[model samples]
Target: MAELRTLARPYAKAAFKAAQEHEQLAEWSQVLTIAGQVTANKSIRQLLANPGLEEQKKAELILEVAEDGVTEQVRNFFAVLAENRRLTLLPEISALFNTYRADLERTVDIEVTAAFELTDEQQQKLAQALSTKLERKVSLAASMDKSLIGGAIIRTGDLVIDASVRGKLTKLADALGS
Candidate 1:
C-alpha cells in the first residue's frame, strides 16, 4: 500500500500543480474522483490488468466512463498514466490530490459521533472550536451512536478525541485491573 502511494505521489502532485495553475482545482478534483471510481470497478480493474489491451484503449475506456467530468487536461493526464501503466493508481492519486487540495484550501473534514444528535448551536460552537484548534477551516460531519451512552468522539485525520462514556468506562476498568 505504501509502495502504491509512493508511486502515485508524483502523478498526484503533477495533477495538483496543473489544476492550481489553471485555477481549476474543484473541476480537476471532480474529474479525478470520477476517474478513480471508474478505475476501481471490478470489471474496469480486470480490463486495466489485461496485458493484451493497448494502453490507448484503456485510457479511452476510462475517459468514456468519466466523460462528463473530463477536460482536455484530464485527457492528457490519463494518457500519461496509461502510457506508464499507472492507471491502476487512480484511487491513490485522487486521495493524494484531495490531501493536497485540503492543505491548499486551509480546510479539514472532521467526524463527530455522539450519543445524540447535536443542536445547530452546538454544531456551530464545535466547528468554531475545531477551526481555532486546528488553525484551519473545519467542516464537521455529525452522526449519532447510541452505544456511546454520552459525550462524543471527534475524529480528524490521524487525531482522535474519545470523550464517550463508553471509552471512559473502558479506561477506568483497565486502570482498576492494573
Candidate 2:
C-alpha cells in the first residue's frame, strides 16, 4: 500500500500536472475512474494478460471497449501507462488525483456514524452545523451501527465529535474505575 503510493506518486503527479495544464482535471478524473474500474475487473485483467494480443493493440482495444468518455488526452495518458506497463496502477492514480482535488478545494470528507440511519433533514442539519463550524463545505458519508446504541459520531480528519451512547458508557465506566 505504502509502496504502491510511492510507486504511484510520480505518475499521479505527472498526470495531475498534465490535467491541470489542459484544464481537464474533472474530465480526466472521470476518465481515470472508468479506466481504473476497468483495470480492477478480473475479465479486464485476463484480457490485458492475453498472450495472443499485442500491447498497443490491447490498449487500443481497451480504449474502444471502455469508451465511456475517452478524450484524446486521456487516451494518450492510457497509452503512456500501457506502454510503461503501469496501467494496473490506475486505481492508485485515481486516489492520488482525488487527494490533489481535495487539497485544491480545501475540503475534507466527513463521516457521520449513527446508531440508526439518518433522515435527509438530519443529514442537512448535521452538514450545516459542520459547515458553519469548519467554515468550509463538508461532504458527508454516513453509516448506521446498531452497536453505537444511540447518538452519532462525526469525524473529519483529526477532529472527532463522539456523542454515542457507547462513548458515554465508556466515559462512565472510566470515571467509576478511576
Candidate 3:
C-alpha cells in the first residue's frame, strides 16, 4: 500500500499542477475520480493487464467506460498513465489528488466515535471548536460505538484524541503493568 502511494505520488502531483495551472481543480478531481472507479472494475483491470493490448487501447477503454465530460487534457493524462503502466495506480492517484485539493481548500475531515449519538447542536459546536483550533474548515462525521463505554474519540488526519472510558482503562492497565 505504501509502495503504491509512493509510485502514484508523482503522477498525482503532476495532475494537481496541471489542474492548478488551468484553474480546473474541480474538473480534474472529478475526472481522476471517475477514471479511478473505472480502473477499479475487476474485468477492466484484467483487460488492461493483457500484454497483447496496446497502452493506447487500454487508455481508450477506460475513457469510454468513464462517464462523459472528460476533457482532452484528462484523456491525455490517461494516455500518459497507460504508457507508463501506472493505470493501476489510479485509485491511489485519485486519493492523493483529493488530499491535495482538501489541503489547498483549507478543509479537514474529522471522525468522532462516542458511546452515544451526538445532537446536531453538539456536532456543530464541535466542528466550530475544531475549526478554530486547527484553523481549517472542519467536516465532521459522528458515529456511535457503545464499546467505547463513555466519552468520545476524535480523529483527523494524523491526530487522535482518545477520551473514552475504554481508552482510559487501557492506559491505566499499561501504567500499572509497567
Candidate 4:
C-alpha cells in the first residue's frame, strides 16, 4: 500500500497541477470522486479484473460508467491510464489529490469523538480551538462515542490529542512505568 502511494504520488501531483492550472478544483474533485466511487464498487472491481474481456472493452466500460462526471480532459486522462494499465491506481490518486487540495486550500478535516454528544457551543468552540492550533481552517466533524468513556479525542493529520478518561489512565500507567 505504501509503495502504491509512492508510485501514485507523481501522477497525483501532475493531476493536481493540471487541475490547478485550469482552476478546476471542483471539476477534478468531482471527477476523482466519481472515479473513486466506481473503482471502489465491487462490480467495477470485478470488471477491471475480468480476463475474458479485452483491454479496450474494459476501458470503454470505465468511460461509460464515468460518463456523467468526466469531462473531455478527464476522459483523455482515463484513456492514458487504460493504455498504461494504471486504472487500479484511481483510489490512491483520488486520495493524494485530496491531500493536495487540502494543502492548497489550507484546510484540514478534524474528527472529534467524545463520550457524549457535544452541544453546538462545544462543537463551535472546539472548531475554533483547533483552527487556532492548526493555523488553518478546520473542517470539523464531531460525534458521540460512548466507548471513549469520557472527554474527547481530537485528530488532525498525524496529531492526536486524547483527553478521554481511558487515554489518561493509559498515560498515567505509562508514566508510572517509566
Q: Which candidate is the best by TM-score?
A: 1
* Per-residue lDDT of candidate 2, residues 20-85 (tens digit): 998888877777777778777898888888778777776786667566767787778778877887
**What TM-score would you give candidate 4 relative to the actual structure?**
0.90
Which of the numbered candidates is closest to the native, going by highest lDDT? Answer: 1
Better of 1 and 4 by lDDT: 1
lDDT of 4: 0.83
> lDDT scores for all predictions?
0.94, 0.82, 0.92, 0.83
What are the root-mean-square deviations of the candidates from the true structure over C-alphas? 1.4, 3.0, 1.6, 1.8
- What is the clash tally of candidate 1? 0
Instruction: State every prediction's TM-score relative to the real structure.
Output: 0.93, 0.79, 0.92, 0.90
Candidate 1 per-residue C-alpha lDDT over 23-120 given as tens digits, one digit per residue, 9 for 90 to 100: 99998898889888988899989999999999989999888876675778988999999999999999999999999999999999999999999999
**Across residues 60-128, which tens digit of lDDT does each residue of candidate 4 receive?**
776676566567677767777777777778888888999999998999999999999999998899889
Stretches > 4 Å off in candidate 4: none
The number of clashing residue pairs in each candidate reads: 0, 0, 0, 0
Cα error, candidate 2, residue 77 (Å): 0.9
lDDT of 3 at 18: 89
